[model samples]
Target: MQRAGNAFVDLIDDVFDNYRQFQHSNDFQQYTSWAKQFKSKLSHALNTWIPKASAFVLNLLSKLRTSMTAWWFFLDHPEVPPDNNLAERSLRLAVTKRKVSGGSRYN
Candidate 1:
């Protein structure tokens, strides 16, 4: 099941990777169809397994389900990156500056 989930994610990434070439063409409809199918599979997986999952896994799934729309931006706007790596990297500069200065000091 985990492998299946991973494959689904990879498939979504592969679909989005072609967005630049397809954004303005009918090819994008293929991605839209894939996105809807992925959502259905995800929902089915959750319904089938979540009840038997551990508490931690349940919580994690809750978070994923809640944030799924944001992650599925490719469905509505395929131009957006799939991950927040750039936003995360932007925070490194602030962290480095703080460390260079004096580090955090809070009560």
Candidate 2:
């Protein structure tokens, strides 16, 4: 299970690396090609690993499978990012303030 998780992370990392490279070069065609390959690899991995996965991993995979289209939405739009890091970062300060203040009485 650990090996499978590690391999899945590695695959995602590889795809992100390739996406960055293609983005830098402004190579839409290359990105499209890589996206197709990624879809194939991801599908194969899910098929192969999900069957052997534990309950926790199976739950994770179930969410992933259902949200698969959202996951690859960035591939269809050059302006979209592959991750939500920027949005999350933007919310960090607000979240921190809310946590520090505890619950708001008005809300």
Candidate 3:
């Protein structure tokens, strides 16, 4: 995903990072279809284009665009977090405790 450019990768990154925020929407729909449609476009691009490299790029770009569109569902939902920052920042509590104590399981 990192190889895909920041703008393109951000959507999937947000999806995985902030899945809870987009699981549901004000329209009473889930984000599942967005992901599904994104995948379908990628598949079609790959299958339709004869040149493999061009097809792959076209697919990736298309998927990235669709994923970004899916992010709108998050904006539509007022109850969900803006991003995954809520959960991410919350994790500091555990990390701080670990630092104060001996450490995590590995540490």
Give all TM-scores, in the order shown.
Answer: 0.58, 0.80, 0.34
lDDT ranking from best to worst? 2, 1, 3
Candidate 2 TM-score, true structure as reference: 0.80
- By TM-score, the best candidate is 2
Worst 10 residues of 3 by lDDT: 44-53
lDDT to native, each model: 0.69, 0.85, 0.53
For 51-100, candidate 1 gives per-residue lDDT tens digits of 76677877776776788787666567666756677999989999999999
Candidate 2 lDDT over residue span 1-107, tens digit each = 99889979998898789878987998898888888888889888888898999999999987888899887787677578888899999999988888899944475
lDDT of 2 at 35: 81
What TM-score does candidate 3 reach?
0.34
User: In model 1, what are the clashing residue pairs, if there are any?
Assistant: none
The pairs that clash in candidate 2 are none
Off by over 4 Å in 1: 1-27, 66-74
